[model samples]
Target: MGVCTSQNVQEKIDNIEDDYLKLDFNRFSTYQKLENIANNIAKQQQVDTIFSSLIQRMIASGQGHILKILENIDNQKKLGFMTKLERLDFEFIDSLFHHCYKQNQIDAFQCNVIQSTNCQEQNFDLIKEHKVGIVFLCGGRSSRLSDKLLSDIGLPSKKCVIQIMMERLKKILMLSSENKEINDYPIAIVLSDQNQEKFQMYLKSQRDFGFQSINFILEKSLPVIDCKGQVVFEQETQAIMTPEGTGTIFLQINSFINKFPNMEYIHFLGLDNLVGLPLDPQMLNLISKQKADVLCKVIETNSILDDRIFYSNRQFKTMDEQDSNITENSYNSTQMLLNDLYLSVSFLNNLKYNHEKALKLNQRYHYIKRGSNIQFEKHIQDIIEVTDITILHQTEDYALLIDDPRKAVIQLSNVHKRYLKLEGTQEEDLVEITPQMSYCGEDLRKFENVSYPLII
Candidate 1:
């Protein structure tokens, strides 16, 4: 009837509902628990190092599936999904499914949250008057990409792909800036944990690129845990190993924008997104012609078999590329999978659910906080007041999914494979900083093998 304070939280923890904790399934006997753990440990061998490496890959790919799951739940298809499930064997799927249920709890903990995407700057000039600020979320430890950002792609110019993507956005934002379409808009980049110092050093000493305001910030880190709740590796007293989720950036990046208050529009792009982004980075002036609440850049799903491929891209291109390139390194790139249809369902469902969970987390925070009874009830209303988002379908080509981390590593490997076949694969011209890079928009190549075909 009232809000739960920290004291209330302890009381509730001491006394959970008998029915709530009582799982209906009768398979949960003590014998069953021991048997399952034993079996899991035995099968753990079957899992191999490959599966451990695939965790992020699988998660990235599954994000699409997670989205499908969210949509079904929102539309009251839970029972239907249960009925449709006949021959599926999901080990942690149960955990993931349960985790989605607790998203509200997570949202509760993040109550003082508000997200902004566009600029409201008044000083409109000729050059940067139209230039928009775009921050790329590229700072993860991609063990698959073999730490591709600082390292070369083994191509002609040997520039890192992050540099490739940065150049692309630079040209796009500054396209008309020459004639003063926009002022010198700075492109901010969020960096990874281990590589923060490296990025800063490069910008100062060997800063090879010309993108202005090529600023960097370290991605938040937490801790790495094993099954027994033990740390996998000793963590630094100052730096934790576990980083915040992509969703957490809605809050983390705001600190960096303190000085640049005059910024108008901001593009929150995924880091290792080498394929391409919506709103051609060169066409920033037109990308926000209308100025909607949240302009999500979505790719046209090519067909039904691209989820695995999509997940790979999402993990490597966006998260891992920004983290560590070693995610793809040298091994375990070949045995990845991509099934497009199911994956598409997953992506949408994941976003919906992630949003939902964020809301729920806010609720849980209320239940666990030290608030007065009346204050706690008021917090519930806060949860309901959060705005649902709008999606803008980007009329463009190419789709990349980051839900699956392994496939992402593999995908980066594929990018390198493509470059290796070329004689002189220079970083995109914009990366090198010349007047011509901004003018040349004719080389954008389209494809026929696109697999996930769905409306965003």
Candidate 2:
């Protein structure tokens, strides 16, 4: 079936009677029947205008091809599938093509480091009094982390990435309980639809990791566009889609913040980091003491893969200058790097405001080629260009991000050893397991608490 043409749309519009009779209360006393009559009349008049505007907007944004694809599906069915708000979301994505970041437009500045040990008891006291929340960005597929969360790396009991993180959260909560001022801290996990069910089940199996309340924020998935600028179909009815990037944390958690009006600070981190402390009091203290809107924990870039964290040290470039440097990878010259971000509710509000405004503008969309398909992704770090960010330098080992299976196994083993030492456990009691040792499908339930020796 072809899309409704202008004539077809006009016919529907022409059929709507402007002088339709208003209901008389005595003639139709039943409220339900009256409501149905009014709704049918309103829907008939509004459908043409709503759909015509949607199609025109898509055409204006160079997405006319999408309209053709959408026509092949049932028109009413497709419209019913997406709410008016959801349609606006697709429009916002289209605007990204016009208002993208130009590499040369950004300025970088080296940030200074503040040692965690330097924090005082007074700072900790303030942190205990502050109402803070933790957001775990766990939306990414563990494709790079061995594709299985349960890849065991020699633990006392066999545990996966999620299990270890749950344990870590339990410890943080336990520590928080020691403080009288701190009560009812909420932890939210931001997950994608693909992983939400599995993750929830896993959490339930782990008994909620002893946390009284754990909220979930599901990330919205945007449809993928092909080289021809047409939406790619995953199935007959569904479109191929990917999760909007980590920067989406601002929008996803906005409602959660509204619920807890007193939530002043949010500490967010990625899921791959096994050693990350959920609500590090030092970080909380730094943000509170500095009176900063955003406090980013940064480490000097030692590896090529690490993005340089930079302060906005220069003025906004002129339109002419921006146009001249709009070539491929032009922004790679900037030297500063970013680690992770801790945002205040005020900062989140600012981000939300900017994002809402940006959607109205004609923004450029940047696409990356992933093998045969192209992907559109944005980063939380990109906010540095627009927002004033305060940076605190920490060691690279503050948290370890697991990307490779073998390397992560080695790193997890080392982290485990360090954890044992931190607990004042002697090395002699450790029962080291070789790298060659596998679960072997045997009844190895007896191996619990048997620490495997380092693979060095």
Predicted structure with the largest TM-score when compared to the true one: 2
Q: The CA-based lDDT of model 2 is what?
A: 0.51
RMSD of each candidate?
20.0, 12.8
Backbone clashes under 3 angstroms, per model? 94, 20
The TM-score, computed over Cα atoms with residue i paired to residue i, of candidate 2 is 0.60
Evaluate model 1: give its lDDT: 0.36
Q: How do the residues 341-367 of candidate 1 rate in per-residue lDDT, one tens digit apiece? A: 000112222434576655553423121
For every model shown, what is its TM-score relative to the native structure? 0.43, 0.60
Cα lDDT of model 2 by residue, 329-397, tens digit: 423332233435677788767765776434522132335544555556555555544545444434344
Tell how far residue 31 is off in model 2, in angstroms.
41
Candidate 2 regions off by >4 Å? 1-94, 98-130, 141-157, 179-183, 235-238, 302-339, 346-368, 385-389, 398-403, 414-451, 454-456
Write down the TM-score for model 1: 0.43
